[model samples]
Target chain A: MLLQILNIVGIVAFAASGALVGVRKQLDVFGICVVGATTGIGGGILRDLLLGVHPPDSLSKWPNITASVATSLVVFFAHPVLDRIWSAVVLFDALGMGLFAAGGATVALQHGSGALGGVLIGATAAIGGGVIRDMLVNEVPLLLQRDLYALPALLGALLVVVCESIDLPQGISLIAGTAAATGLRCLALWQRWQLPRARVKD
Target chain B: MLLQILNIVGIVAFAASGALVGVRKQLDVFGICVVGATTGIGGGILRDLLLGVHPPDSLSKWPNITASVATSLVVFFAHPVLDRIWSAVVLFDALGMGLFAAGGATVALQHGSGALGGVLIGATAAIGGGVIRDMLVNEVPLLLQRDLYALPALLGALLVVVCESIDLPQGISLIAGTAAATGLRCLALWQRWQLPRARVKD
Candidate 1:
C-alpha cells in the first residue's frame, strides 16, 4: 500500500519535471505530454526490459499510465501558475527520486536480483528518466552535470541494500532511504555542490 | 555476405542522416556525433533489449560502432559536401528502412514471435532510430507525422510472413521484402502519400 502511494507520487513528480522542460523548450501540448509520460515511466520500462520482463508494469497497469497522463494534462494547464512555485517543483522532484529509487531496489530484491543488481537497478530507475528527459530536450543531463544527482540515488540504493542485509523493516528502510536521498539532493542544491573536474581545453 | 554489406551501407546511410539533423540543429561536434550514433544504432538497441539480449550487438561489436562513429565524423567534417548530396540521404534511408524492417522480421520469426509481434518489431526496428532522433531533437516524431513510414515496414513484414508460409526461399523472400518496402517508401514520397487526418479546429 505504501509503495503504491509512493509510486503514484513519484510518477506525478517526474511528469512535472518533464512538463517543465517541455514548456521551457516551447513544445506544443502533445509534445509536452509525450515528454512528461516518457520521463514519468521510462525508467521502469527500461528496468523491466533489462530484467527480461515484457510489457512492463508501467504499460500493463492502467493507474501508472493514467497518473502520468493526468499529470501531463495538469502541467499543460497549470504550468504558468506552477512556475511561481519553482522551488516546490524541485522539492517534489527530489522526493520522487527518493521514492522511486527505493521502490526500484525493492522490486528488484523481491524478484531475487542480487545485491549489486538491486543497487544498479535502483540507481537506473531513479536517474534514467531524467537522463532521457534531458537527452530528449538536447541538454546535458542534470545528473551528469551538477548537484550530486546520481550520487544521492546511488547512496540511497546502497542504504536500502544494507538495510535488507540486516533484515531491517521494509517500511523503515524505505523511509530512511527516501529521507537520505531527498535531503542529500536538497543539500547539494542549497550549497551549489558540483562534481569536481579539472579544466580541459576543448 | 550481401546482407552484411547492405547492413553496413544502411548503417552509414543512417549515420549521415543523423549528422545532417545534428548540423541543422547547430549542435557541437560531440553532440552531432552522439546524435549520429544514436540515430544509427538506437533502434537495434531497443530491439535487443526487448529480446532480453545483453550488451546489444551495436555496443558489443566494435566494427559496427566503429563504422557508425567513423561515418558520423566523416559527415561532420564534410558537412558542406554531404549537404550537396543530401538528396541521396533520403533514398539511402528508405533503403535502410527496407533492409532493417526485413531483418527484424526475420529475426522475430526465427524466435517464434507471432505475426503481429513480428510485424511490430520489424516496423519498430525500421523507424525506432528516427523516433529517437526526433525525440532527442525535440521534434515531432516523423513516423507519427509525415510519410507512410510505418506502413511500408508493416507491409514488408507481412510479405515476409506470407513468403515463409508459402515455403519461399529465405534469401529470395528477404530480398523481395526489402525491395518492396523500399519501393513503397519511394513511391509514397513521389506521390506525397499521407495518412488521413481530420482538420484541427483549434
Candidate 2:
C-alpha cells in the first residue's frame, strides 16, 4: 500500500515537472500532455524494457496514466502559481527520484539482473524521464551535466543491491535506499554541491 | 532473407547518420558511439516493448550491435569523406525509413495489434531512433519540424495494415508497402514536397 502511494506520488511529481517545462517552452496543449505523460512513465517503461518485461506495468495499469494526465491538467491551468513554489517542486522531484531508484533496483533484482545491471537500471529509471522531457524541449539532458543528479540514484541503487545480497528484509532495504537517495539530493540542493568538471582546456 | 538484409541496411544507415550528427556536434568518441548505437536499434527496441516482446531481438542478437559499432567506428574515422557524400547518406536514410516502417507494421500485426496500433507502432519504429539521436545531440527532432518526414512512414505502415486486412500475400504486401514509403520519400527529396505549416505570424 505504501509502495503504491509512493509510486503515485512519483508519477505526479514527474508529470508536473514535465508540464512545467512544456509550459515554459510555450508548447500546445497536446504537446504539454505528451511531455507530461512521457515524463511520468517513460523511465519505468524503459526500465521494464531493459529487464525484458513486456508492455510495461505503467501501460498495463490505469492508475499511472490517470495520475499523469491529472497532474498535467493541473499544471497546465495552475503553472503560474506552481512556478512560484520552485523549491517545493524540486523537493518533490527528489522524492520521486528516490522512490523510483529504489523501485527500479527492486524490480531488476526480481527479474534476475545482476547487481551492476540493477544499479544501471535503477539510475536509468530515476533519471530517464527527465532526460526525455528535457530533450523534447530541445535542451541538453540534466543527467549528463547537472551536479549530483545521477549520483544519488546510483548510490541508492547500490545500497539496495547490497541489502538484498545480505538477505535484508525488503521493507528495511527499501527504506534505507530511499533515505540515502533523498537525503543526498536534498543536501546537494541545500549546499549547492556540484560535481567537478574535466579540466580540459577546450 | 530479403527482410534480414533490409534490416541490416537500415541499421547501418541509421548508425552512420547518428555518427555523422555526433561528429557535427563535436562529441567525444564514446558519445559518438552511444548516439550511433541508439539510433540503430532504439526504435526496434521500442517496437518490441510495445508488442510485448521482451529482451528485444536487437539486444539478444550479436549481429545488430556489431553492425552499429562497426558503422560508428567507420564514420568516426572517415567523417571527412562521408561528409562529402551527403546525397548518398540521405538516400540511405530514406531507404531505412521505408523498410523499417513496413517491417514494424508487419511485426505489430503479427503481435495482434489493431490496424491503428500497427500504424502507430510502425511509424514509431521508423522514426523513434532518429528522434532519440537528435535529442541526445540537443537538437529539435527532425520528425516534428522537418518537411514530409513522418507522413511517408505513416503511409507505409497504413499500406501494410491495409494489405494484411485484404488478405494480401506477405511478399507482395511487403514490397508494396516499402515501395509506397520509399517512392514517396524519394519524390519528396527530388521535388521538395513538404507538409503545410501553420500560418502563424511568428
Candidate 3:
C-alpha cells in the first residue's frame, strides 16, 4: 500500500514538473499532456524494459497514465505563476528523483541485477524521464549538466544495495536511501552546487 | 542473411549520421561516440522493448555496439567536409530509416502485433535512433519538424502489412516497402517537403 502511494506521489511530482516545462515552452495542451505523461512514466518503463519486464506495469496500468495526464491538464489550466511554483516544483522533482532512485534499485535487485547494475539502473530510472522531457523541448538535459542531480541518485541507489547486502530490513533501508538522496538534492539546490567541467582553452 | 546485412547497413548509416551531429555540436570524441552508438541501436531496442522482446537483442549483442562505435570513430577521424558529404548522408539516412521501418514492422507482425501496432512499432524503429541522437546534442529533431520523414516511414511499414495481408512473398514485400519509404524520403529531400504546422498569430 505504501509503495503504491509512493508511486502515485512520484507520478504527480514528475507530471507537475513536466507540465510546468511545457507551459514555459508555450506548447499547446496536447503537447503538454504528452510531455507530462512521458515524464511521469518514462523512467519506470525504461527500468522495467531493462529488467526484462514485459509490457511494463506502468504502461499496462491505466491509473499511472490517468494521473499523469490529469495533473498536467490541471497545471496547464491553472495559469501558474512561474516564479512562485518553480521552487516548489523543483522540490517535488527532487523528491521524485530520490524516491525513484531508491525504488528502482529495489526492483533491479529483486530481478537479480548485480549491485553495480542496480545502481546504474536506479540512476537511469531517476533521470530517464527528465531526459525525455528535456528532449521534447530541444533543451540540454539540465538534469545531466547543472546541479548535483545524478550523483545523489547514484548514492541513494548504492545505499539501497548496501543495505540489502548487509541484511537490513527493506523498509528501513528504503527510507534511508530516499532520505539521503532527497536531502542531498535539497542541499544542492539550496547551495547551487555543481560539478566542474573540463574546458579547452581557446 | 539479407536481413542481417540490412541491419548492419542501417546501423552504420545511423551511426554516421549521429557522429556528424556530434561534430556539428563540437562535442568531444567520447560524446560523439556515445551519440553515434545510441543512434545506431536505440530504435531497434525501443521497438523490441515495446513489443515485449526481453533484454532487446541490440542491448545483449556486442556486434551492434561494435558496429555503431566503429562507424562513429571512422566518421570522426575522417573529418570530411560537411557540404561535400551532407547530401550523401541524407541519402544513407533515408535508406536506413526505410529499411528499419520495414524491418521493424515485419518483426512486430511475426511477434503477433496486429497491423496498426506493427505500423506504429515500425515508425518508432525508424525514428527512435535519430531522436536519441538529436536529444544527446540538444537539437530539435529536425527529422520531426521538417521533411517527409515520419510519413514515409509509416507508409513503408503500412506497405509491409498490406503485402502480408495479400500473401505476397516476404522478400518481395520487404523490398517493396524499403523502396517505397526510401524513394519517398529522398524525393522529399530533393523537393523540401514538409507537413503544415499550427502557427499562432502574433
Candidate lDDT scores, in order, read 0.75, 0.79, 0.80
Q: What is the lDDT of residue B145 in candidate 2?
A: 41
Q: Which structure among the candidates has the greatest DockQ? A: 2
Full ranking by DockQ: 2, 3, 1
Candidate 2 lDDT by residue in tens digits, B5-123: 76777788888888778887888988889998998888888788787776788999998888988998998888887545556556766777888888888888888767766876787
**Predicted candidate 1 versus true structure: per-residue lDDT over A58-111, tens digit per residue:** 754677867887887787777666534446546756877887788888778888
Expressed as tens digits, the lDDT of each residue in B1-202 for candidate 1 is 6555656666777777887788888899999899888888887777666655678888998766777788889888987865454465567678778877777677667766656556656766777787788888887665544557767887887788788778888787688888888899999888987543322211
Candidate with top TM-score is: 1
Candidate 2: residue A201 Cα off by (Å) = 3.7
Docking class of 3: incorrect
Clashing pairs in 1: none
RMSD of each: 7.0, 6.8, 6.7
Once fitted onto the true fold, the runs of candidate 3 whose alpha carbons sit more than 4 angstroms away are A1-42, A49-123, A126-130, A136-138, A142-202, B81-89, B193-202
Worst 10 residues of 3 chain A by lDDT: A193-202
CAPRI rating of model 1: incorrect
Q: Estimate each model's TM-score.
A: 0.63, 0.63, 0.62
Which CAPRI level is candidate 2? incorrect
